[model samples]
Target: MTITVSNLQPIIAILAGILILIAPRLLNYIVAVYLIVVGLIGLGVLRHFS
Candidate 1:
């Protein structure tokens, strides 16, 4: 029942997919946010906060 860091991406992906299917217009924002988050993770920017 625990939500670990490793479990986040797939969860987010599923939610994003669902959201996109429900509202196609949100695809742009969803992708933009996902990319920004991933880029920040890649740069280790969010590591300090965790």
Candidate 2:
């Protein structure tokens, strides 16, 4: 199984949103990690074609 771009954004957004909601104090860390992960994936450092 692979993950396509179309399927990636919403999941990431929801997860980040949840984390931010659950721990408002962790927003910075969560956003940083989320951005890094998504950036790597977007840059093709990681690829999932679902």
Candidate 3:
């Protein structure tokens, strides 16, 4: 299936979940990175749609 912008969040969530499951210690870093990335997206700093 094609990966559109809408599909990116869930895919990332799934991957993050798996990573967290494998290594619980990564929770802090994962959350921090996720928030930063999402914030950048919201601010149009990272344009996946363009």
Q: Which stretches of candidate 2 lie above 4 Å from their native place? A: 48-50
State each model's CA lDDT, in order. 0.86, 0.80, 0.87
| Per-residue C-alpha lDDT of model 1 across residues 1-50, encoded as one tens digit per residue | 77655678898999999999999999999999989988887788988423
Backbone clashes in model 1, listed as residue pairs: none
Q: Please provide TM-scores, in order, for all candidate models, with all chains considered together.
A: 0.82, 0.63, 0.82
Candidate 2 per-residue lDDT, tens place, 15-45, comes to 9798889999999898888788778877888
lDDT per residue (tens digit) for residues 1-50 in model 3: 97766778898899999999999999999999989888888899888742
Candidate 3 least-lDDT 10 residues: 41-50
Candidates 2 and 3, the one with greater TM-score: 3
